[model samples]
Target: MSFIRPEVRAMFLRWREALVGAAILLLGLYWSFGVTPGLLSWVGYLALIIGAILLFAGVQRGRARMGGGGPGVVQIVERRIGYFGPLNGGLVDLEAVTSISLDPTEHPRHWIITHEGGPALHVPINAEGADVLFDAFSSLPGLSPGRVASTLKHEGTAPIVLWRRPDLEKRIARLH
Candidate 1:
């Protein structure tokens, strides 16, 4: 029933970027310790090396996404901030969703947002049954109507807001 598939390829963009950055930094540090004697120069070199690697990876990945080779969905279910369920077929806690908005398109469109201290994910839903899907998300208990807004303006173009992130820290605090 879900469109988004669970795959390494589907890992969030920010996660990928962070992972790549960490990898580059670690590699640079290791290399620096081996070849450099000056601490300041070593740190500088390490930064330069890490930056270059991350930059290269970002560009390549961007090109891939633009080319339509991005990860295809398996089962895409929106989740609230504190919880991460199985992708596609999982339930999201309404309290964690700070906002929900519909993405605008040339045709009908729907998207969900989750606040994760990053840009909102503009998930594209199947247009045919979008109304039903929208209803489903909207009807979730505790969902705030004010959070869901149409991205479209008078200009006749825009992306839809799907869901926004609520305060995740509070959720975690409650759980713990």
Candidate 2:
């Protein structure tokens, strides 16, 4: 029997990375300012930097995560993202993606990933394995993780374009 309630456990699981990062940050603080000396102090400084980065990334991932169990399953393989949902689903290649947008007008927000020569794939934010999209989206060229996280957390009714391929932007500008 577990003492922790299921809801509490699930919450912890969702923020596990941030929790770990916080712990590391604490350890680094203690080592840097507490009783550690010389080389250990320097190491502690390094740890501080690493901890801060991890914490930032963790917070971003945590914000992006929508607790799953919404609808559909998301899979990313070989840089391709595939969404399998009851009503709608599609596959999007990360490399060929031209734009990524968030449609907050939906019941549960949906990520509209548009790729070259294909229909846009609409993946629900809370879909199972959707958290993995954080890493996948981060790997896209010139995409900013901070911007993505901020956009994901924004409470807006209109659709927001999160990222666009730089080359595509230049091409469209040239044509206009």
Candidate 3:
């Protein structure tokens, strides 16, 4: 007996974080510009800053999430990512990850997580629990949420390298 339609509900759930951030941003804006001076105004300024950061992060997270229902399950535990797909599966340690790439040529697109001394683990963009990869990928050094989101939205046929370990880049440069 739900009043909301399924599609609307799904959309809301997908952008829940951004929606909450927007609410906070609006509240902060009202407080900062509305009457009531003194300490309350200072608090409003603080809220403004926090709200802005949350809003930015939320938007990135929202963009990174490609709806689920793909063929697999992703799990992150103790700084390791495990993907169990119908045909193939593998584990990738966060610390050992040397590069992250996106293969949009595939039917559902795939995130190619390459690690040191191991075959790259290909996880579909819409795999179950894949949304959590946003947080995992963000934890990598020098990887920005905005860049991840942009890479996810890339329309290229060839795989795009989203991130590469700085140390690895230097080593490769030395070899070349």
Which candidate's TM-score is highest?
3
* Candidate 1 residue-wise lDDT, 1-176, digit = tens: 65766664555542465466666766666666656577755785767677677755554333223112222232324533221222332234444455666555533243555543455444444322232333345465554333332222222465544343446446867999
TM-score of each: 0.28, 0.92, 0.93
Candidate with more favorable, higher TM-score: 1 or 2: 2
Question: Would you give me the overall lDDT of model 3?
Answer: 0.91
Shift of residue 156 alpha carbon in model 1, Å: 3.1
Ranking by TM-score: 3, 2, 1
Per-candidate local distance difference test: 0.45, 0.88, 0.91
Provide the lDDT at 51 for model 3.
85
Model number with the top lDDT: 3
Name model 2 segments beyond 4 Å from true. Answer: none
Ordered by lDDT, highest first, the candidates read 3, 2, 1
Question: For model 2, what is the error of residue 106's alpha carbon versus the real structure, in angstroms, after optimal superposition?
Answer: 1.2
Q: What is the number of backbone collisions in each predicted candidate, taken in the order shown?
A: 28, 0, 0
lDDT (Cα, tens digit) per residue for candidate 2, span 1-176: 99999999988988888888888888888889996488878878888888888888888887777888989999999998999999989888888899999999998899999998888899989999998998998998888777778888788978899888998899989999
lDDT of 1 at 127: 26
